[model samples]
Target: MEAHALYELLEKYRQGKCSPEELEQLERWYASLGKDRPDSLLEEGSEAAQVLTSRKLQELHASLGRERRVVPFRKRVLRWAAVVSGLILLAGGARYYFKPASRQGELVKEYRIPAAHSRHITLPDGSLVILHAGSRLEYPLAFNNNIRDVTLVGEAYFDIRPDTAKPFVIHSGSLRTTVLGTAFNIRAYEGSPEITVSVTRGKVKVETEQEGKLLAVLTPDQQVVYNNMGATAVRQPVTADSAIQWVRKDMVFENLSFAAVAQSISNRYHVNVRFEDEGLATCPIRASFNGTEPLETVLSVVCGIRNASYTIEDENDILITGKGCLP
Candidate 1:
């Protein structure tokens, strides 16, 4: 199932509203999806080994009755930490595993991206994340009973799996996006002038880092853009299909400026692209091209449509100069 459909179906199942057939479909879907393993098999001392140990612990705890033991929360957490640490040691190489590292229990595991490189990741709970270049995501390896949370730096598109009991929370720089299983996009690159959250499906609540700032709720197709410029604007919902067209290797532009389009293309292709002429910076253009297309071909097509001209300087920079340029 696609992300949105899976989310909806999961939500319905949780609410006791799904038909029997739909529930079966949900089970089938869950079983069909599995994590991608690296080349090396996980040893008992590896991180993955520790994860398996943690899962066993969870199974043991589940068998306990609601009448419950009198174990203190702190002690319980520490015990789990030790188990997880030992497992990581078995899963990964033993030399790097430290007990302290286990205590750093992340509810979502850490996600890393190389400079100028974006990546698609699947969360432990089956949610999806598209991390922009040079971004990091810190989440616990697994979410315990209550809140599901994650911290993000940079940009990502989220296709969350619905589980109302565990509302998904994203801490992106100074902003937070909260949802009970929704699809959304967040752009909060460090040093970027602004933070943005655009909702494509379901609903999301956004709040500023500073307290007392009222939550901003977004409906499908809506976007919230906020920055220190004292500007917080709500815009008519743009089609998320267009916003995330990069996922398909297609770059779509509807009256987008040359500079903006170039930035997006750069991120998509993991390349440095420069425009030599300031005059072409503000030029408005409408076009769509696969990201894998030759850079020269893309520029040529855009220039041809506008009756303009361009020249590549040593294949690194492109200069577009012409009368048709809209400044």
Candidate 2:
């Protein structure tokens, strides 16, 4: 995401040598950067479009807490103009592997995991899958063109087979994750506002399923959290192993925010965690728990880390109080 690296990517894109994910990234960038700007800008030969195009660069600068200088815009705009100019071309050249409608009487296999239960199965292409509790997975009886595609309604961990010529794609809600060969986890349970993809090995490409807007290209230990309702995404480093601990019916936390950990616990135990101060919600936690541990024991350990105390109001909700992080 550095300026020089972006420039290199653009150059590679121009040469038609960029990988599938890279091209999708550039396309998504152009889409997001050009949002609500003006069609005339692109039609008018990028005089004003240049101004809108530089916003992406500026947005990156803003995120880094750097001062924006008018002096740099003039020079940077020229490099960005080429990317904006190709938006139309990218639209025309766009190719997607998804087929909206199945063939008449197509042989599709669907597996649904009940609540509080998990299931493991081998995909048609020899890929391995472990579905979390209350998850569903659907796929064709056999893959076509060496390209495997599956739809997920909840969370799943996959160990995909290597196939350079074929890409494996997973569709979850509005998020689409594409991988050539990777071990990754996708969490996209129904009615959840956020969908997450975490990679343990190899590379993965996260994108918007409807708009084909690339979200992020992730390598090992990388994760992208996409908020479907908010239409936003954040990519961050993670302990990939911890993210998929659900496969073992265990809880793993590695510098994860208290708010997130709370959600995980609530989902597993069918209880909500409430806090008075946002500070408590933001506390960083590092711990692991066996699935058999009682809920109160887990809360006790978590609160002890932050010098906090929790009192269960009922089986449905619990309250925790603390000043902030204790250590």
TM-score of each model, paired residue for residue: 0.46, 0.46
* lDDT values, one for every candidate: 0.62, 0.70
Model 1 reaches what TM-score against the true structure? Answer: 0.46
| lDDT against true structure, model 1 | 0.62
Candidate 1 structure quality by residue, lDDT tens digits, 190-236? 78878888888899889876563645899888888877476464555
Which candidate ranks first by lDDT, i.e. highest?
2
lDDT of 2 by residue, 65-91 (tens): 232233243234334434333332322
Worst 10 residues of 2 by lDDT: 90-99
Clashes of 2: 0
- Model 2, which residues run further than 4 Å from truth? 1-105, 250-327
Q: lDDT of candidate 2 vs native?
A: 0.70
Candidate 2: give the clashing pairs: none
